[model samples]
Target: PGGAASNKTYVIYSDNAFPPYEFLDQSTNTYVGIDMDILAAVAKDQGFQYEVKNEGFDASMGAVQAGQADAMIAGMTITDARRETFDFSEPYFEDGQILVVKKDSDAKDLSDLKGKQIAVKTSTQGAAYAESKKDEYDLKLVYYEDSPTMYTALKNGTDDACFEDRMVIQYTIDSENLDLKTVGEVLNPGDYGFAVKKGTNPELIEMFNKGLANIKANGEYDKILEKYGYQS
Candidate 1:
């Protein structure tokens, strides 16, 4: 029932610092990332109105749950826990957790991580994956609210390694020239999706799914992913 000309703007939220996926771009002084671009593309295709809020992940999730935001697309993994509170569209991205260590660290694999500490981002699949393997690896897990801080933990030697999304860690390391390297294979492979408060925004979900299909059919979806260096 809602369209761009209806004068109704849906509030959508994303984490501003999560580069490549969603972050604030200083050159253009605007928010841009895979999630941001996908949302824009979808709105354009579906002819809807929306206001993007580039807040932190926790804040964004809270906003959607509190009914302040109508939806979110922050590279959030589709998990059963999240499904209970939010309705998710078909998965738009494939991602998985990976281990990162200082370039000079001796951590070549999870097997080499005995008695070490690993950094994790709170409330993310990364953190959850770390917890699931911490005991097996004989590791200690340190939590951070954001990625940069957690990455710093590894660089500063405060943490022997970190668990984060493979694409995120790889992109950041190369773009920022971080003194880090990924070891071992990706873990907890899963898909990412756009989400709305459960059972509240059926139309929003419908529009997103429609726009997503259009993009994929028109090759716009692959273009967006390739633009972000997510696809070869």
Candidate 2:
């Protein structure tokens, strides 16, 4: 059996407003996205109970770091820096960051972003990559708690450009009909994983990985990705 059929419940924390990964479905008043569906399917397949917290990304990280959450699956990238604080599961997804500008804008890359504020979600690899090139590109970085806010900043006059996951930005642009265009080459290619506080929740990790494997074999994993419009 993948899971031990524990009656005990686990707590999970995730970013609330990240699209194609996690978001509030206002019509149904339910949380739905790639991350949420993956977690649900994995838990059911593993025969475990869990409760999800829809805190924003910044707060979710804090909750997990403080041991308030057993695991987190917030489209979170796996990185060596985060590994120091969290033990991550096997990589579930691969992605890369890219720069975005408003449609009709002349900015094509970081070079064109000189003196412009670039939007970045707090504590993300995108933010880190933007910072790494800020001086070289002559760019200023502004942080946002969620993707929508960051996109809105670019839509308005608050920000000139932004750095975000390529597919995520593409998803938003297509779904919301945003007049945003991704520019420049992709940056910081990486993998996404579920994470637990370092050295803790080994059983949860074991069951999760087992369930994940089962789902992949049974096509549930690909179905979830399709549900969120991700090409499996």
Candidate 3:
């Protein structure tokens, strides 16, 4: 578990549109984001190489589970349920969920969203958090394959609100000038981890952990976060 396989270029799957975490840079037409930078930095530090696929998060999860991808580094939460199927590395980032709505919408919080359509990216922690309160709030959920589409639904009045990562939605709102605002307190605060299928690639996890530690110690981790305009 201490060293990676020599000359093996691991296949890593990741979200295609999870901005700040993972997203396409249109100007260069290449993938670039905090997660991408961090992974590259860590791999360089640990003397390993990988190829990342910018598939959606759900697809990434499925790919890893099906043994099509060696690992994943999307902005995936480290949940106990997830631990059952995937082994995760030490946490790399902390975040929480927030409810977002059109800026002029009257909904001020979860209580005001009763029976309203709530958009969610499928199979995300944000989706799970909304599911837990669906009954209590009488919420109707609308699932999308990715965040940008879910946000589009909310902005165009197709959905009344959406639950998303606090940092992610905020960045999208600011960068894209989307007419959306957060409405509720943060929920399900947790850390993001790199993951691989459980009981497989223990050495990869070991390399990731060691590389993450080294990057954090040598300041590359902080630089990566700051490059994305996120405070480390």
Candidate that would win on lDDT: 3
How do the residues 1-232 of candidate 3 rate in per-residue lDDT, one tens digit apiece? Answer: 2345488999999999999999999999999999999899888878887999999999999999999999999999999999999999999999999989899988888889889899999999989988999999999999999999998998789999998999999999999998999976788899999999999999889999999999999898999988889777
Q: What TM-score would every model get versus the actual structure?
A: 0.93, 0.96, 0.97
Query: Tens digit of lDDT per residue, candidate 1, span 1-232?
Result: 2243355789999886788998778899999888998899899888889999987787888999999999999999999988999999999988898889889877787789887888988778988887888888888888888888898988888888888888888889999999999988888899999999999989889889989988899899899989987662
- What lDDT does candidate 1 reach at residue 34? 87
- Sorting all predicted structures by lDDT, with the top scorer first, yields 3, 2, 1
**In candidate 1, residue 145 scores what lDDT?**
80
Task: Decide which is better by TM-score, 1 or 2.
Answer: 2
Model 3 — TM-score against the truth? 0.97
**Backbone clash numbers for all candidates listed:** 0, 0, 0
lDDT of each: 0.87, 0.89, 0.92
Q: Where does candidate 2 stray beyond 4 Å?
A: none
**Model 2, range 73-92, lDDT digits (tens) per residue?**
99899999999999999888
Which scores higher on lDDT, 1 or 3? 3
